[model samples]
Target: MSEFRDSGTFQGERMPKRPNIVWFLAIGATLTGVAMPMGTPAIAVSAITSHPNQKSDPPSDRIAAAMRAYLRDLAAKEQFTGTALVVRRGEVLVRAAAGAADAEEDIPNRPDTVFRIASVTKQFTSMLVLKLRDRGLLGLEDRVCPYLIPGYIRTCPQAWRPITIREILTHTSGIPDIQQLPGFYIKLSQPTTTRELIQRFVNKPLDFKPGTSWKYSNSGYILAGAIIQAVTRKPYGTVLHEEITGPLSLRHTGYSRRNPPAGYAKGYFTVGSPAPPINGSQAFSATGIYANADDIVRWDRSFGAHTVAPPATVKQAFTPQAPCPSNGCLNLPSSAYAFGWLVDRLHGHRLRYHPGLLQGYAASNMYLPDDDIAVVVLSNVEETDTNGIARHLATMALKSASAHDH
Candidate 1:
């Protein structure tokens, strides 16, 4: 055993000590008293080489650390207050929560915090329509007017009366945006039945001939939701819960108007001196889906796994049906409308993405099928650039994958 002792030196002066001698009978020479000086060069050498200081990070960990640091800096600079998640082939690569869920309470956002998904809910409504088609209970080719209330398409031009479910899913039904109709917003605040909602727009005129052009009309999706209700004999929300959210075990996802979960971010719009909170009602089917980043990822994965719709049906949802004209599309450089998703190209990679913006909440979800990458961003701020953040995260996740490949 080796033992160490501290030897103090005063002004570089060495202290002396007495030595002892030992005699051996068989040895020719006697063991004489010998003085071995302590704190010599050998002791100093061992102390210097004992344990060298070094960093603990491996190369992969170092890269991940740098990426996290950059994300933190970017979030702070951009004033991003949301949760971001990145998953590759069903494996979570990164799940980070930043900023406050409720700014007033100073509660930091968490993975399970839910927010109104806004237009992202349209995808779920579209999926329900496609599922019904797969079950042979409905046909996309059937004219929607016949199944709906009488005069449902009377306001549309005579040429557009033959609009089909496929046309509505593809946003080519030529129905006007409900928000643009007079009294639509006011009526949205009220508990209007699906039939009443349809009747209100029955006499409205179409913007163009059906299937001749692409125009995103919320009324078209609401009509689809109503059709789901009519076919299933259940509320739209209940169908969504049973068909989509339930089988996936998405506990944090739901359409609720009563008490929401704790730590939920209050939606805010910057209008007056201080932005007022926006609490959306439960009646809106074209837009209302309350979920978090984690839940959204699960929802996206359901497509790849064919958990909600068949693989072919899911494929149709991400395939561009028609080119979107101005005033109805987001103007993505390489994007077009599919069943509900926006099919586009990002950095030469196919992307299925969508953004949801309501009164005080904004959310975005993106999936790169070729690379099996998906990302979701959920924010409470109505005007936040959440699409930009989602793009950045997707880029980072892809970059991480490329680096791993090398």
Candidate 2:
């Protein structure tokens, strides 16, 4: 269970400024009349203090100091075992790592340590879908069956011949959850491609009609990744690197297939006994992206500054598409899954968030648009409450930011 507490109430602060690179791209794209696919927002430049070294602490370091103390307490309590990054506008406000990157090796966690992002990778896949739509290569309204392998609709009585890209993006395609698949957890040891995985279960019946309701389906995002491949004739990793990671200089982020970086945490499942390390290759498009807290802060800044996709596209991704049967809308107290994010409200702040879980890894990333704050938590323990840790830290960060603003 996650615990979130906002100790003090304060007015919202101004949105932070974008880096020069973001401004240059935005202006260049605007001048060329080329749509800047970046969806980051522009805030007042005062939110961030300029410095020669990007790693240098900000001018008002109260937030960072508070966060560090909080993290130290959390680590001492065994409540967190990963890196946490809190940034406002484009400045690195609080960047701290706790616990161990490699628990067995006794290596201390660092801000640059990479962990498997798990379902957080969905956002990247969703971004690719939006990019394709912007380029006219695809449409949210387009049917999925036409682009997918044949007989995809054979198993679903309610499923029409096709599912839309929009349906898949919003998890309304009525596809069965990946957890429901037979031997899904056990099959992680085997090498499986996106095509093979889809072929194995594409004919399965739909849980509901496309777009009628929302359900969290990893299969839909996997299919979305496959769609990227089918249209671009390139691997999903290549597309992700060229389109998103490379441009942003997210050097620590990647879809690792074989060897991962040194000091990386090993994934483990505490089944009957502790399970062995899970490889990144097992996750493929559905998960598999590796990154650290600092890199994700860069990602959030890009979103906050409108540096990647246009603001309109980013809005579409965050906006609730179809109603969730239980909640009736994406606006709920706890996190409600958006296209690639878990949409929610905290202390009157709107958030776009997502959490990732694998055999031995857990992660969470969230963007609070109201306060221009983004929090990312990455852990090695498989079933650890990463979201809870993120929320706790986020609450603290927001409180500190509010105090600083006053």
Candidate 3:
């Protein structure tokens, strides 16, 4: 079983800042790709710190070149071994991969190489559940107990307010994270049924009451997946494949365990060795999906196309849920997560994205609606700082679009 962390809670989360390049870019009115070493940390430093004016735009070619240069630098420094893509209005600005898919075999990583996308799978789960709700198969306000196995919820009758689907989707459900429980990693690798899975975790009292506050819990999604199965009488992977992936012809997206395919870029905890494989059954819908950067960009654009869910419903998922009336929302300046997405701003443009981290893989996908831009980064190597790189790419793409629009 995979021991999953709330991928939303990544360390080194950063806030917006201005860098020395602002005046340089605004006054110079051009960007020439830096002649810095590929392994230099300077590009990442500037990308993170150099804030720009919303109106101040730079050349498209210059911005793209700088973005590539930044990734090249990152690949050298981090020894990154996956693909990175930045797309706007269906145009790919940057697509690059580095390092080895299987180092012992000396196979180089390619843009098409598949990697387990980890908790980024939550976004797909949220979309699937919301789509069901949109079609009247389920209700966000509906109590979860009816769908979950009987006698399972009896253990926590006092805490179970029939946890609403909305609560589960928003991570506001009072459910405690099963992964935090004792012997979680040991339990993770064992084969367990969905009913048994819920029973194992549902006995504890909720961390907080439903709809009252926010705490990221994979268990809530675990329940949501159960609800989907109970309502549709289909396997979780089957639902995703038929409803979402099939509709889009997303040739590269699905659960890594249930539907094993060839060409998987071996995920590695150590640079030279493979991470121990966990039972996919234990991960379920919470954190057990995989895909490539190219396939993910299609999933990102599903927001605009409304291919899977209606625009209104997808918009609701993007909108941040209301916070506790008494405590107020957490005072986070850098970004906030609503549903499955990280909603933030880049140089005054709106960005909605999600990051997923697993034992040997790291992935992040970003989309800027106002700018019509999307960024995808997936790596077989851990601590790739996928989201950070994706964000920097967004910054460069927006800069290019801004210059073009002006």
In model 1, the Cα lDDT at residue 80 comes to: 59
RMSD of each: 19.9, 10.7, 10.6
C-alpha local distance difference test of each model: 0.64, 0.65, 0.68
Whole-model lDDT, model 2:
0.65
Best by TM-score: 3
Which one wins by TM-score: 2 or 3? 3
Number of the predicted model whose lDDT against the real structure is largest: 3
The parts of candidate 2 lying over 4 Å away from their true place are 1-63, 150-160, 270-274, 325-336
Tens-place lDDT per residue, model 3, 220-305, is 88888888888888888999998888887677678744433665777787566677665667778888887776678777777787
Q: Ten-residue segment with the worst summed lDDT in candidate 2?
A: 19-28
Each prediction's number of clashing residue pairs: 1, 19, 4
Q: Write the per-residue lDDT of candidate 2 for residues 1-406, one digit (tens) a residue.
A: 1111111111111222210101111111111111112122222222334433434333345555566566666766666666666665544455545554544444445455578888889888888889888998889898776676542223433364667888887888888877568888887766666666776567688888776777778888877887898888788789989989888777777886654566465564431124565555557777878876666777776765677789998888788665555653323344445678767788888877888887777888888876777788887767667788788778876776677677
If ranked by TM-score, best first, what sequence of candidates would result?
Answer: 3, 2, 1
